[model samples]
Target: MIPAHEKSETHSKIDPDLNSKGVDEEGETTDHNLTYYQQMQEASLEQLAEHRALLQIFNLHQAGRIEEKWKENESLVVWLGMQIAILKRDFTEYSNCPAHEYNGENRETDEFDEEKELNELHKKVLELTKLRLLELGMFDDFPSKFELVETSRPSKNTINKRFNKLLRKIPSELFPSIRELKFKNYIQSILDGIKKITIGHKIYYNQVTADLEEKGKLKFDYLFQTIEFLLRDHFISENDLKTLFQEDHILRIFSIYFFHSSQQGFSSMVKQLTPSFITDQCFWKFGFSFSQVLDEKDKVRMNFELLIAHLFFNGNRLRGFQEWDSFEKSFGRKKYLDHLKNPDRLKLSTSLQVEGKEEVPPLSLIGTDQEFSGDVNNLVKLFLATLNGPKKTRALSGLVCELLDFINSNISPGILDRSFKKLGSSKNLRLQFDLILIPTRINYSMAVAMEFHDIAERNGLSLAPKVMESIFISYQDRVISLNKELIKVYSQFKNRYGSLSSWLKQNPEYSKINEKSLNQWLKAMSIIIEECATEAKELDRRIQAAHGTAH
Candidate 1:
């Protein structure tokens, strides 16, 4: 800690500088105080010899001279004396005393002629101090080294054991077939996502984060599909792929996959790959020479079409909505259109409707598997509207109309209101059911929309009711199972009470209690539970009838 006197002196120094600059002593005018704080910090750090020693040690270690200086002596006796002299001189110079003082005797002049003597003394002291500083090596140009303990490197066996431990954390299931087939070569390539290179068949992952790869296997399913697409497009050949796998040259494959993944369109892949190999050269059998680069618009259409095809027909995973079993059901039922109320909608004669003859198909099957036999002009108009229109309801209405046409169902506002009433008229239950209805409605809506487009007669002969039953089983089963559990718990509570009325009568001492309201609520819940059980049983019956399965 600095002394109070020294702090006063520091304040006085700051006042002079502030007064000279016409700034306030409080420093309110300045927006930044960082400079003042930084100077104080620097001074504090400099005054501490230990801090300087630590800095010097760090420098020496970085320069690879730590081992050489690890045994050097660091005695500070000589430095201590020099520091004391410097402090004494500074204190004397700054003291509030006259330069000269009369000796304790009668004299010719009141002031003694000791000014020159004091100057001579000061000069001699300064010279002596300089000599001492040099002798003590106080301002020597060389950096001081600190004595640090030497550490030994781990033995090869120890290193091997640690490396094996890290490798064991990764599961074998996540390993590629190439990794499984070629152990030695696979070890050289990047198994984990740690960014490093192999030099002369030695793996060198970043030592700073070597254990990062042990966290878990990252999902690269998207990258895998992209690889498959490239192979199909002949952008990469089968033989080359096999060679990469055999040699464990995964980096090359990664290079191409990431490049294509980040780019906009499939034509970009062709443009990018063309430069890597000759089109008309020896490896021309993959149809590289004659392939034309698609324009941006065409590429978008083709890729979008491919995306829809993969998602609906080829059973590809949808990005975020992969969790719901209903999503899987929707994808699986793409083959069974036996339930369509309007089967003629599947045989899209034209994309438009003739005024007197027929009504237009509600859902425009833009990326259907077969060529769109619809009117191209109307299709273009709808496409443009979908792309540029501000209202999503226009698109949504089309989907709803299509679904209604398929399910042979109609929505009446009265019916919906009545159905909601059955959930419960109480505010709390209404709110709960409202929340549950959001997801339920979404599931049902999506199921109808997807199942309507099942033009492929892939699944065997099944009736309309059976198709609806299949689409609804996952959702209904979940609701039934949940409600059944709730009923079981509530039944246990009722059994414990002997009856709700008995429990309510017993608790009448509580003034806030409304026994009548409680009885009504309990009775309503029992009815609700009974209805749920009945609905569940009906769903089970439908499921059984559809699949021809026993309970």
Candidate 2:
């Protein structure tokens, strides 16, 4: 244990990184003090999208990276030192020999082997460090030999100098008792510092963040659809698409599907497919082609509609409420409509902020997905206003990003409690359900709006009460099946956890690795989080299944 005088210094270093810009002197964590992963968890949805986009650029999701510049990094040097110390401690304890037992060498004897092991501990330390890092789902991404920088590699002397400098930064009041500091407590501080450095290393770029905020409004489902519309329009013919793309079919899926929403893979896939052929191409399709946008066929003067379409995902993601009416009537949803007054009073909105894209692909790619910055109050207000203004009650759900985010939150909550109950007490009851609840509600909301201009029949009209009940029955059955699968998952996770604990038992210092990294790796390997469709999607399946070919 450290003397009372040194306790403060030890606590100060062990608890917080004094040099880290965002932390307060008192070691209180601030927003700036958070690790990158923690910041990601708390970031706004728009911010999250940009961050994920940046990750795609860096290929960070594959594994963590280490840069050449980190060789001289104080935190990394200290971590290497700390790791070497740990190796020595474990080796000494397990060797069952005193430090004095080193009479230099015999070739084959166990005593000789012990001496050799002690001599080789440094190499073992590096191997142990890499193994530990790999277990945390990371690998060294340091530059190859030809890319080496001129800086000297970290050595014991450098580590000592850096560590001493760190020690000197402690308040003078705590300096007197430095000799009393405990080894374990000191190493723990190094661990904290190292973990923070790694977390920062995995994700750090000020400019990308700035770019995300600046261009966020342009990156939405409309972007993917816009890309698709253009992609389909790009090729000379179907044969052209097939010849250029290995997975050409992935592009034909006009909605958010596969990696279409992830700018990571999507950008890389289309990086070569630039549209230099026509700034006027929007005139060819969707009324925004370059030809249509030009003031005259040959003149370069731009049209407002062309610019608006370019900036906002081709003008369909957001539109006026009145347009919904015109679209339904002129574009043919006349059969489902009733007359309503002041349809033009409000503008419709959806397609979350270009920045606000969710990581999970929406089940349906449409304008109805919620806006990132919207509130429940606004959605509720819209619901109330429609009751009075539009007696016909069509073209609603426009202003609010309705149902996509939170329909499940209050939508007939607890109505399913009795339905969710199993009939038999037996755990093995097999159940089958057609559609999850959220998707069905999303479908219902879209049906009311008729954004796609389909008549009530094929749209979502078939999802009346009885049909909804059938879908619910399918969902309940799926829930039971999911529970059974979860039980098996639990058993597998238990075994994995036991194996991890047993491995760590062989080296107690492994406990000091970052808890977040451990948990992330554990959860990823175990698949603890469930994956299912968004509300828009489940509704479609439910609808299609219900009306596959009625008599």
Candidate 3:
């Protein structure tokens, strides 16, 4: 006899017939498919959510607990795994099948990952078993004090493993070599490749190398100039450059190189760049990605600060060398003339004004397709998307610095004082503007749950629990997709920016604010991260209850 869990009706609910429509031969059955579709969609979403929750519980369970459960499900689990393997085999070949030419019996199966479906089914089975156990009050059987004492006792191997785990959890900044293994490998390969190029072009390589290597030390200017010449001359292909320097690894490498080769401080190193280099219009010479060079230190706060200083004050967009290949190739094109014009009010004042120094040359804006504007609102969008993809917090942070730079450069002290008085309430500040205008779903959901619901209710608009659940779950997925690096960076930004703004307000001087702002931002970012994390926990509970998964 089939188990109640494996009933035909259960299977029908799990697998909707895609070809079915609202109409049926019998008038009474006309809405059957429609009802089925709605119910199936709802069940599908609940099951999907339960899959995630079960995965989390599995991850968090102790090894002993996992082993115990595995024993309970061993044979059925193995059979399910084999079935999944067969489904995967069929699915993989379905893509290449010639049967796709017809919609008849030879038609290819609809696109899907068979393994994924089977895994979901497996998880559902386990969830049902878990529910049954819960119903039986199995958890109410508490262990004796003696048993607890014995189970809690740690062995020598267990203690060592725990210590190692703690060490592994330590932030990567303290162990760069361990954390940046991929980066280190790539850098070494590039250096080796460059060193080998000297074999064929011995004279040219020696000349450049000798010029750059002054008294057993590599000069930064010489290094920059040589790299620029090599790139401009088509000595290095765009693909090779991208492979070597993509994702701002160049910034980290430069940081390491600077520590080794230069006695000058980070600020001094930046001071060497020309005024035009920092402005938005221009990309760098040979391309260097300086987005998150200091990401490991001070929890990305310092990275943001350095990026801002480098771009606005020291004058390096640090966009990376790949961009230079395109810009250099299109050098003479009368394109992007709009941006080539004097930057909008958004551009930070050049170091010429900051240092009270003479103009080095005519600051020719780099011609580009993208226009640079002073609008922090649009910039905040890029900042949020950066959480999901390639552009790091550096872009947002640099823009923040630019906004700060402009405010300090343009706004008077008395006006700034007035702005500070209205600071917490006013959304004019760039950071606050970002918090208000970023348009994140979670931010909106939080507002609705806390305040908007009441306003909506008064206006005769009501929010359904399902709508709120959807929003929170969507946000949870986004947070999960951020992986680790971005989560830390974003948390840091939300935390640090508040204090950074406050400190900047009190001090009101860019020169005085300096890197000391790093710690203040770090502390603030940590607090924000903790608060948001707590909120996420609460949201998870609500989501579970909505899905009928709460204990």
Candidate 4:
């Protein structure tokens, strides 16, 4: 019998038969196939997310950018150990496959030496994700079967005191080396091979919005120039950017976009361009043998696909390399984009007069076939998807930086522009967005539970279990309402773009859009990280404090 915990992943057009059965491990038949689709999608998402994280580590190593100090990081060592003893103790009987197969014996390297290298790989991926996906292994949710869990969790104190299992990292050999990997060609085929997509299924195009030779020119230039422009003056120095982002890191990010676009003459040739783990996972289909799982007529499905595409693919959209990528790559829930700006109206208004240029070189606005605004809203969506995905929060944090770049990038000196910002938010981000936004039921949920936990810890008061449960229900409602409010606000803001005429585009909505927008964005972020969902009110100011972040 497949154990209840056995992971299954499925991503495809919904079987036209809702009459299809959804079966559980106990051989019980209950709901429709969508239930099973979600379950399998979620299981596959976990595999994809883990695969993506490991892939990024290899990418960092090849790029020679994994930090040297990661070699013996203790947190990493602890993170990469044997499987959780409790699971081995109890659930082993339920698992058909081991959480991981251990083969330390007869390997070329000593177990200690191999552990050390893997520790370093774990650390680098954590840092890499601190900028890109959900912080993995060392922080947030471990890719391991046991997640740290979502809201209303026991205080880190209570859980640590009870279950201090010394888990071992699985052998690295369980995974395929970059060369041995079989997913890339499949992804390219999705992009390069044009199936007979009808109107409702216009997710992929032959040129991929252009042609290969231009291989993501519009989005690439947009991200590069946007990063340079944002960091160029108000945020950091060119010298600092070089030090903060090495050539390999920057160039690879560029190539990620480059290969996915239609570069005029090189359209077909660009298919041969090396794909990154980011690209791979974003478009990853777990041997189901399909590039995309989309239905244009399904508005909800279209929304998921479009949002994923706009946020991760097309061009880096609002995402850019940041100063935080240099130091804040751990999986902590500290507000990642705090420096992007404080959302307090007065502070934001004062802070956002960041640009000094008057007639800057025309910004790259790639208006190919389809374009829409509200790039930043999708980071929140991406964040939501990561928890649900099997998507990682890694890109959520990094994309938060880019969202700031989108929000704070200039239309004219001293006035920030929202109307003109366009990276099209898809293609690679789209491909990955396409891949990642599977909206598998999130493995976890957070809210009032953590708040009560924090309240108990801060005040040193012990309440009865029933009392906490009652309070938990009450606070959860408010948190849910606040989430609705945020969605409503986003709807209003998005509609503003409908009438965003040439003048609105030229003048920009610095006052209209900046303060409330950042405030809502930051507040929502405060709520839904892997660690816990925060109470949204006043959270814009206390993003880090609420998360109990040490650094």
Name the candidate that leads on TM-score. Answer: 4
Q: What is the lDDT of residue 211 in candidate 4?
A: 29
List, residue by residue over 144-222, the lDDT tens digit for candidate 1. Answer: 2111111222333433343344234333332343235343233223222111211111211222322111101111212
Ten consecutive residues with minimal summed lDDT in candidate 1? Answer: 210-219
Candidate 4: where are CA atoms >4 Å away? Answer: 1-116, 119-150, 165-338, 345-551
Clashes of each: 1, 20, 10, 51
lDDT of 4: 0.28
Q: Where's the lowest-lDDT run of ten residues in candidate 3? A: 277-286
C-alpha-based local distance difference test score of model 2? 0.27
Evaluation by lDDT, superior candidate among 2 and 3? 3
> How do all models score by TM-score?
0.14, 0.15, 0.18, 0.20
Model 1 ranges off by over 4 Å: 1-260, 263-324, 333-348, 355-551
Please report the TM-score between candidate 4 and the true structure: 0.20
lDDT of each: 0.28, 0.27, 0.30, 0.28
Q: lDDT score, residue 237, model 4?
A: 25
